[model samples]
Target: MAKTQVEYAVEGIVTRQMIEIGKKEGIDPQWVQKRVSEGRIVVPLNINRPCSVVGIGMGLTTKINASIGTSTDIADIDAEVEKAIAAEEAGADTLMELSVGGDLNKIRKEVLAAVSLPVGNVPLYQAFCEAKQKYGDPNKLDQEMLFDLIERQCEDGMSFMAIHCGINLYTIERLEKQGYRYGGLVSKGGASMVAWMKKN
Candidate 1:
């Protein structure tokens, strides 16, 4: 597979796989080619994954994402992997492993190994969980741990990452000015940060 979408576009040859996929979606082959050429659609292909599917993003059908993982109370890697497989078999565009309790890296690797679909993750969750486990304070987590986790996930062949980079100092100040209410910042990462800040 090509390293970047641009590389895939400049090849000037439409892979048979892309044509067949376009036909299945009732889209013209040229349209698919053009979209790929423009980098509007992304087909995340992992070198280790043999089964690849074209996921149309713009002006395409709504795709489904299934999240499967374990929490601290029930950290069952086997069960989580099974669910992820089922989700893919049932036609999920992507699968995300949000394992917080168990070995996060192990769970992610096993999931990636189990499914051919694009795997996504929220690095902050793993970072916060690890920080709490190690230092008993989430705010104690610095940029190094966060960036390291992000890089590790990327190196692990994650197709995409859901990074909450928007929730920074400015966003917090805005929230504070607006008066933070119970369950205000519903995002898990945002709530975790707020709690950590309050405690620290």
Candidate 2:
């Protein structure tokens, strides 16, 4: 529906943001665009927000992502924004605010304003929470609702998302062999994905 960074880069558009990312990564802007087009690098950016583009994935230095969010038990908006501030000050490459409590939209906006770095989120949290509030369980979450929530976040300037789609039936079975450890299949994102086979 929209021309993404990959589309622009593949078409030979070296954006100002790409230039900045190249400077930071000590590579040429054209190289950055090439990798972006080739799907070798990722620079999650939302045009709604003003943030320096950060290169991630293949051939870049290992980046640090500071997760700052509230659990179901706690939902303090100010505290989350403060964490974003702390993350930026401490040299976090990106920040994922996974607030499942309080006014999520307000918290996201304030947090985005609180830091110049890229802001990310786990949209499934909102979708699952909504399903729980209405349908009585996270398992009842509708896919349409999930997509709607993701669109809202994009509109609100979310630069990235932690969508763990790598887990497939084969991976699940393999992990189950090891008991899946910790939360096992009932983990954060795995529990929702009972179907579907992803690429390897």
Candidate 3:
């Protein structure tokens, strides 16, 4: 297991990524390390992928994370890679591959290779998409499969992930208790999760 930035910071050590980000932010590397140790800053650089280092959190510049994805109707890896490169060229601080179609792993790899920006993703999208394709229903998603997908995505060098840790049974119960919700949920992953919860 590798030591995280926070762990290294706690030990009074500054990582090269911290120094690079510090230079970009015009702050001292020690200050960046201190903030990281204090949980006030995040440098989303995955060990498996070497790309530009970006800092997000308090006192840092606001980062624009551009999302590039493919739906079932239009799953084009080449186009998604172009979008990833375009986002980077357009000064995006970070990029997220949210493709739910085609070979997701291949698409992610191509997108990651397309630019120097740190890349992220929503693991649930792949998990749900795979489940739906395999079983003809997203509701048939297996718990183990979801966990495995998360691990695989991490291994694939996703610097960040949009994991829905807040939408659990307790939240669902409160949602049902409230009743008459306006504007319903707009997130596909969220909607599928709620449906799965209701069924199970």
Candidate 4:
């Protein structure tokens, strides 16, 4: 298996990605490597996706992440690709393809191809959406299915993922005990996970 950036950093190897980010951030590559080894920095470039890299975390520039995706009512792949391009052109350091509608796999690949910015996604979005469509209830989302989807997305060259592994029974209990928040839970993936936890 190929080593991760963290693994390489721990071994004191200054990778090409670190050098590129160092050049871009106007910092020493060794400084970047030190921060990465200490887990204070991240360069989110997937080995499978050969894109321009960006370093995020302590001491680096505050990078902007632009989100583009297809909604249920507006699942236009071409439009989403255009949005990805526009985000890159407008100076976004990263991109999140959060599509929950209309051939999500294809949409992700197209967007990845459209921009050199590191691309990420919320795997739970696709898992919950597919479960809701297949079983008529997001609550019935299978654990194996979710894991498989995550692996597939990674294999498809998603540079990173916003996995909701933090949501569990304990979190649900805490939320229930705390009553209502200002906005409650506005996240679609978060709400789906809560609903699944509540039902199961």
Poorest stretch of ten by lDDT in candidate 1: 1-10
lDDT of 2 at 153: 91
| lDDT, residue 195, model 3 | 90
**What's the lDDT for all of these models?**
0.77, 0.82, 0.88, 0.90
- Candidate 1 lDDT over 10-41, as tens digits, reads 56556665576587778876677667878876
Instruction: For candidate 1, give the lDDT of residue 158.
Output: 85
User: Which model, 1 or 4, shows the larger TM-score?
Assistant: 4
Q: Distance from true position, residue 114, model 4, in Å?
A: 1.3
How do the candidates rank by TM-score, highest first? 4, 3, 2, 1
Residue runs of model 4 more than 4 Å from their true location after superposition: none
Query: For model 2, what is the C-alpha lDDT against the true structure?
Result: 0.82
| Regions of candidate 3 where Cα sits further than 4 Å from its true position | none
**Per-model TM-score versus the true fold:** 0.80, 0.86, 0.94, 0.96
Best by lDDT: 4
Candidate 1 vs candidate 3, lDDT winner: 3
User: Higher lDDT: candidate 2 or 4?
Assistant: 4
Q: Write the per-residue lDDT of candidate 2 for residues 10-35, one digit (tens) a residue.
A: 99999887898888988888988999
What TM-score does candidate 2 reach? 0.86
lDDT of 1: 0.77
Which candidate leads in TM-score? 4
